[model samples]
Structures are given as C-alpha cells and as structure tokens.
Target: ALQRTPLQHEQSDILEQQARDEKVALEKATDQGQYFVFCDTAPLLTAVYSDFVFGDTSLYPRARELHARYAMTLILEPDLPWVADGLQRDGAHVQKPIHLKIAQELRGMGSLHYRVTGSGEARLACARAAVLAGNTHIAATGWRRTI
Candidate 1:
C-alpha cells in the first residue's frame, strides 16, 4: 500500500510559477552574456533549506531544477573555526548540517568545485586561483569569457 501527500494549495503554485519565470529570465541573460556570472548561493540550497529547515517547500522543485542548469558550482569548504558573532548566525552546530546537505545536493548536481581551505589572504588566494583555473579551463575548451 502507498500513501500520498495532499496537493499544495494556491500559494505554492504561485511561488512555483514565479520561480519558473525567474529562471527563464536568468537563462536568457546567461545565454546572452560573454563572461560567466558568479553567484554565492546556487538557489537549490535555498530550496533544500526551505524543504528541510525553514518550514516551506513551495518553491523547492522549481529552484532545484533551475540550479541544475548552471554551468558550474563552487562550494567553499566549511572547515574554518567559528565564533558566535552575537548576530547573523544560528551557531555552527545548526549550520553544519545545512552546509553538509548543501554539499550533498551540489554533488548530486555534478558541478561542484570545492574551494581550498585556510583563512585571510590564503582563502582569498584560493578563491582567485579557482577563478583563474576556471578561466584557463574555459580557454582550453574554447569557451568565451563573459566577464
């Protein structure tokens, strides 16, 4: 025997429609651009957060689908030590699982590139190196830079 979850109400349908429309716009822009556009959040992570932690799943499917359309994904490693900043944090314990889920989902998407570890200039240099490496890869593959 099987059970089924009830269909989502009108709000979820509206949100899914909005996400689809936005993804179409972004895809149009991305196709028109020369160099690549870099983004911090891959959007699917937001979907994951919404589904698992944030008590909302309305936009998850659309967001996850659009994120899979991205050319590449860079995931910053989360091995750095943390201090409670007294603001803007849910503590590392809460965040670590979310971070791991992001990594897992990104891996499932098959485009993840993990950033090198360390802090300050070391991390900065790692980021720069990743971009440079991406550029080199593009050149080697005969792709044009967008930015």
Candidate 2:
C-alpha cells in the first residue's frame, strides 16, 4: 500500500465528504435510480495517464487495482497522447488526438459505461443522448447532469 502524502490525504478526505453529501442529495432528488457524476480538471488524467504510460509497466497494475476499487465510469481527456517514453517518435505528441486517445482508453477499460465527447456543445448533445438512451449518470469535465 502506498502512503498518501499530506495533500493527497486531504484531497481524499474532501472527496469522501463530497461523496457522502452527494449521496444524500441524490437520494432526495430521484426515486427510481440515482446517478452520480464526478467531474474534475483534466490535470488529474494528465498526471495519472502520464505516469501509467511513461513510468514502469508496474504502474498499470496499480491503476487497474484502483479502478476496481472505485468501479465508476472513467472518462480520460488529455491535451496529448498517452505515449510511453521509449515508444514516442520525435514530435509525435504534437499531432496526437486527445479524443481518439480518450475513446481508446474507454474501450480498454471495458467494463464501465464510458464515452468521449467534447466539452462544449458536443458534450451537451452527448448528455442529451445519454439521457435519451436511459443512462442514470453522465459525468464530464466540470459538468454533471441527471436525466
């Protein structure tokens, strides 16, 4: 088990508190089923994905372990491609498509319901689409909606 830094511990505490509060709110807001969307800045993915790609292959095992514990839909959006250090050709990062990478990660995860949509109108359209398709939770960058 990795020991969390002070800041990491604090962040975990805050997230735990928020999860509890959201659970209560979700219970009150819906009768049939509840959907919880966790949204945060893309830096979270930048850090984790970068580590998973560039660091030792052991990092992937840790990521899988963490994912199993959470069991929520993960949507990864980064400004660059997740390339391991030795795998990248010169300047390949410049042309890497973030949306494609996100879609790939979603597929690799395999279990959770996941998709990649742009942050603006496309995201809204995707949300509407999910609602129409009967998804209980729609999570995106800085946006959470229940429909």
Candidate 3:
C-alpha cells in the first residue's frame, strides 16, 4: 500500500498537483457538456485549506479563476457528525472556521453561492430547491443564499 502522507506535511508540489487535477476534471466535465457538475470538493477548498494550514496564497489565483466558472456553489455547513477518515479530514473543530473562510473567499470573489444546512432529506430538499430555482439569490430560510 502507498504510504499516506499527513495533510499537514503535504508538500507544495502535491498540493499544486491536486489543484491541477481538479482543473482537468472541471474542464473535462465542461467539455463533455455537463451542465451541472456536482463536485463534492474543488480547488477553491484546496486553496482555502492551504491558506488556512500553511498560510499560503499560491493557489488563490488559480482557485479564484476556477471558482468564477461555477454558476453556483453550495456551501454545506458542518452540522453533520464528524467521522475520521485519516489524512483526509482534520476534525470537527476545524469545520466551522474553515467553512467561514470558504464563505469569506466566495464573497470576496463575488461568486454565487449558498450556505446549505439541515440533515438527510431536509438537506437534499434545500439543495434541490437551490439548484432547481436557478435563482441568483435563494431566499434565506433554512439556507443562506450569498452572492
């Protein structure tokens, strides 16, 4: 098995590679005529994480450019229970702060985004409504639509 490097010790080269990989995926999806590419994560998050952990801004330019290509971004809250995934996730303690940073970054870029909350079916319903409405600004109720 390949040795798993701890996230904190992840090198710049690997991080850059991850961002490039994400870019390729996004481009491939767009080229394939995928109208709605549902990425569970993206370079934006990678940039945010890198900045948060290593105080690096190298990924921001590329991340911001890629972020603008998205029609909408659904920022899920850390309301769900935390499960350990070794080297992938930090901990529940970091979720809120990281989430806030993501929102701040989105707002800074003036990207269309929404903060999604709730669990299970309710969560799905909220996200579905946001996507289906295709509204620039989803009204605040259980979710917060931000521009």
How many clashes in each structure?
5, 0, 0
By summed lDDT, the worst window of 10 consecutive residues in model 3 runs over 138-147
In the range 1-147, model 3's lDDT, one tens digit per residue, is 114523544544554565566566767776898646676666788778888878887878877876666678888988899887765677788788899999999999988777778999999998988787655343443343111
Q: Where does candidate 3 clash, by residue pair?
A: none
What TM-score does candidate 2 get on C-alpha atoms? 0.39
lDDT of 2 by residue, 26-113 (tens): 5665564644434442222332434434442333443444343333454434433546445322344533454454455546755354
Predictions in order: lDDT = 0.61, 0.43, 0.72
Name the candidate that leads on lDDT.
3
Off by over 4 Å in 2: 1-34, 41-48, 51-53, 69-102, 131-147
The alpha-carbon lDDT assigned to residue 79 of candidate 1 equals 73
In model 1, where is the ten-residue run with the lowest total lDDT?
A: 1-10
TM-score of each candidate? 0.61, 0.39, 0.74
As a TM-score, model 1 comes out at: 0.61
lDDT of 3 at 60: 82
